[model samples]
Target: MAAANHNTVKYGIIGVGMMGREHLINLYHLRGEGVAVVAIADPHIPSQQLALELAQSFNWPLKIFSGHQELLNSGLCDVVIVSTPNMTHYQVLMDIINHPKPHHVLVEKPLCTTVAHCKEVVNAARKRPDILVQVGLEYRYMPPVAKLFEIVKEGSLGQVKMVAIREHRFPFLVKVNNWNRFNENTGGTLVEKCCHFFDLMRLFVGANPVRVMASGAIDVNHKNEIYDGRVPDIIDNAYVIVEFENGSRGMLDLCMFAEGSKNEQEISVVGEIGKGEAFVPESIVRFGTRVAGRDAVQTLKADDDRIKYDGLHHGSSYLEHLNFLSAIRTKGEKAPAVDLQDGLISVAMGVAAQLSIEKGRFVTIEETMAEHKF
Candidate 1:
């Protein structure tokens, strides 16, 4: 393992798609804070064009590679961000880990398309403790979500009993390659889109999921359209119930066709002594404790600036990159907010829910892990 540049942490980006470009923009904002974008890898022409344009606009010298291997071999960066398609995460990450020179990685959410691959990534990451492998579960860094976590940490929410997260949003946007429309590639809608909620549930409840029951179908999105004579098989709506090992439970109500809904996402948690709720797109949180009286409720709002990031997601995207760079600068002393194990468990919960939906029965996380058997 090589030491990081004392004054600057160089970064390499793999897959210059939508998420990749968002990271580039965020990195551009952090140029003065000891962060530098040194290299990018993506074979897509539009992605290449955007990367080149961004580099030129910043007036920073950058190396371009058609694939991740060339960037890794170049040894131009101390860290790498893997934002490739979900199915490609495992290979990209493993490559980073196996590189002759140590390279820390920040891989996008779900880790990979299956539980086994996630476990493999986790194990490989564990072997090299000097290298940092952070997952892009950016929701935890969102201001409102961070406030909710702060409330939970305050111990007012004693022995959390239940958590509910609802997302009523437009159907999945078409990706550069339409990779998101198929379960084989995206690891099902639950794993691809709902993993953030599941990760939050695990954090609030302080336990891993024990059992899951789910039901859903392709109610609207892609039902009337065919891609090369095949209707998309991804589900558009779902209700998932998860039981945690600590006796707490979680529920997720997802509707992909509800683009006109007033709130895009609402999350609520109830514990023995207090309760908290958050409306994501609105950037507001309402919380109350039994000690404060039955009818008392307090409202909190994230800073107005938190919603200003140039993307559909919250401003936490920039914060996530900031935290990752800070962690690298500290040489593993300042740990990532979301580490590899946290990423893997979140994916496990989603995979379990998807399996439960298919089998029409309660599926245990243990069962899913056992079946994968990595």
Candidate 2:
């Protein structure tokens, strides 16, 4: 309700589902940082109950609301975490941006299901200087990934030429009403799940994408499981190729059925002088130059001592909250680590890749943005 201060920074969470609960717990761990989850809004009784139980464990007295508007009306929060379903992000974000009260936001990734909605959110947020909006592209905060970023920035991986990321993980979990099973809701597998990788690709290359080409389908998961007599159309696996404006290229190899893999994600960045690789779960980073050879490559375990909570995202979400809280306390002196443009471009890359798959051709980022009229 009041301005961001050194005092307790109150928070409200909309859509207390899986990711919403993650934010709740993250804020809980940051209680010593003057953070608290003061309120939560979720229409689903089950999700509400689960979040309430979590709040009770944290000894937080929450004012529960069935909808976000009610939570905003109560003036109980200085910041809000929007963890709603994908399709709903557009409207929920618009409402938050339009609300008179300033509520800094950390919306979960994808920004919105469509590029047009993301553009509108970007424009709307630009008007609200009082409100700081940070998209939850938490993968950037992962210890291993963050380490790779440092190496790249330090010029350890000189003149980056290619970046490749492989995610061999299980299928998407069942969300409220199984809404994630369709392309219309989740923005297809590329935008829905691979946006994280796309974001990482952009950072590793340090350039904007120029075009994308992809091939994927619903080949592995949710084939026989039908929801309301309609089978899922969302692709479960894909190989996406992104061409950047700097002539650096990126590739994504995704497989939802490879649950047997040791590491959930493995990323490699190859430049002119050296190459660096990071592995999630394994939490490892390796770097080597041509002169050093593969045998001489050094390996180290990636870890952030500042991370107090290691949640579902390998402590990235916790790290993200730490950064967001610091930025908030600065009172806009510091900007969000991942801004709206990063979110928009990540979605655009995914959208281009998705379109590429549908049309069986390379989709230029220019062409994709032109269609959105942004």
Candidate 3:
């Protein structure tokens, strides 16, 4: 492993697709903060073109590689971002951790498509405790979500009992190769998309999920579309309820076809002392105390310019990247904002919920984990 460079952190990216390009763009903006985009790897021409355009636009001296192995062999980066497809995460991450020279990794959400793969990645990461393996659960770093975390941590919302997250947005955007439209590749809608919400739920409730019950189906979008003579099997909507071990419960209401809804994403938490709600897209949060005569709603909005990057999916993504880079520069002294196990547990809830919906029974997280022999 290379010696820590406290002043600057070199970064390499694999699978320069949509999300990968977004990270590259963020890294470009973080150059002032000692972030350097040293290399990018992608097999797809379009992805490579976007990477090149970004490099040229930022005037970054970036090396382009046809494959991630080539970039890894170059030994030009201290931190690597694995923004590959959902199914490829395990293999890509394993390769990175097993490399002779260690590199800190920030992998996109769901970690991997299945429990077995997630465990494999986790075990591989454990072998090298010197390397920091952070998962991209960007929502927790979102301004409003961060504010909510503050409120909860301050005991303003004492004994949080329930969390409700609703995301009513357009159907899944077409991927570079349409790999996201299948359950096998993306781990279904819940794991692919809603893992962020699940991670938030766990954060707010402060406990692991014990039981999950869900109901959903592919009732909209892709109803008439077929690929290679096969219809898309991913669900378009779902209502999942999870009970945490602490007895706090969380609910998710998701609809993929409701694109122009009032709020793209909304989160509400109820606790013994107060109630807090957040509209993520609007960057607004409301809190009301339960004390008599002082029960009034207070509105808060994220006014930080740092979260306002152009073309990013969430304003917090920039912060997420910053957090990961800072962790790497600190030589794992500062833990990542989101650890590897948190990412795995979040996916476990999604997998359990999907199985519960399919089996028409309440599924325990233990059952889901055991089923996968995790």
Candidate 4:
């Protein structure tokens, strides 16, 4: 196996959907890091063809499979990236964890559709210490976002008090089979789309979310679209307020119909002493102390020269793969930056927010976790 000697890491990507293909492209850019994508598994024929064309470009002869089990049974991968749909995460993750061979994993985010499933995967992974799994919460690796994290960690912001993230972007892209068109499959819009922001909020606050209060509905987008005789129930816009254990707060303002917006994501972290902000796509960050006043604010373009491919996610996906590869090559010396616990909490936060909107009140994370007796 490629990982046995830790010389070259071989990868297999399950569900070669949009995000999975992004992972493939990111790995392709990381070829200099001693990595190669050896295989891909996807039941959808069109997705397979698209990925095949990509692999052929890289001169990578791939072993394609119709299902994840076949990919696992083949023993062709040292690390497997699970970018399957939100609802399928648990089953695919369980199969990988239970398989005789311990293949390290980098599962795309939200972790699972529900808190119960996230906890199940977390517990299942806990039993396999030899296996390393990372959730693809790659937003943290975004240059501007990473710089903001640094500013906070360096105590320049001084005990962060609030984090407000606004993502005003286009609607979700069409996925294979249109599995993302409904709440049942995508875990609703908040859990499916806003998990990244929720994860970022937790990171900025440096604490787990205690409760979430949200207000949202299917205001626009996919109103007339019907798939399999059902209209899409996924919410298109929402305002979510999260309270962290540290008494700090986080807010997310999401809109799927705002294509005219200049910046897709605008994150502001305010501390007791100062404030810092990150703008995605613009890749800009601004910071200044309260005493320094507005005149003293410093702004800069954020860039990480290590990124060889700036894929769909503003180069964060490339950095994410690099970080995972380093952890795999280091054996037990390093751990995944985004562990299962991080994944679970992120999903839990999203779930709490979703439930909060449903119940029209604040939903506690404790109760959300207790759903499956976690």
TM-score of each: 0.95, 0.98, 0.96, 0.98
Candidate 3 per-residue C-alpha lDDT over 1-374 given as tens digits, one digit per residue, 9 for 90 to 100: 33367657888999899999998888887878887888999999899988989888898888999888889999998889999999899888988988998888889998988877887788888889989999999889878888888888888889999999999999988897788888989999999999999999999999999999999999988888777787899999999999999999999999999978988889999999899898867889888888832548899886457753745656677888878777776778999989989988988999998888889999998887774442
RMSD of 4: 1.5
Q: Which of the numbered candidates is closest to the native, going by highest lDDT? A: 2
Clash counts per candidate, in order, are: 0, 0, 0, 0
Model 2: lDDT to the true structure: 0.93
Worst 10 residues of 1 by lDDT: 303-312
lDDT of 4 by residue, 1-374 (tens): 35555578899999998988989999998988889899999999999999999999999999999999999999999899999988899999999999999999999987999888988898999999889999999999999999999999999999999999999999989987888998888878888888889889988889988999999988879998988899888899999999999999999999999999999999999999999999999999999999999999999899999998998999999999989888887774799999889888888888888888888889898999896532
Ranking by TM-score: 2, 4, 3, 1
Error of 4 at 70 (Å): 0.8
Note the residue pairs that clash in candidate 2: none
Q: Which candidate would rank higher by lDDT, 1 or 4?
A: 4
Q: Candidate 4 — what's its lDDT?
A: 0.91
lDDT of each: 0.87, 0.93, 0.87, 0.91
Better of 1 and 2 by lDDT: 2
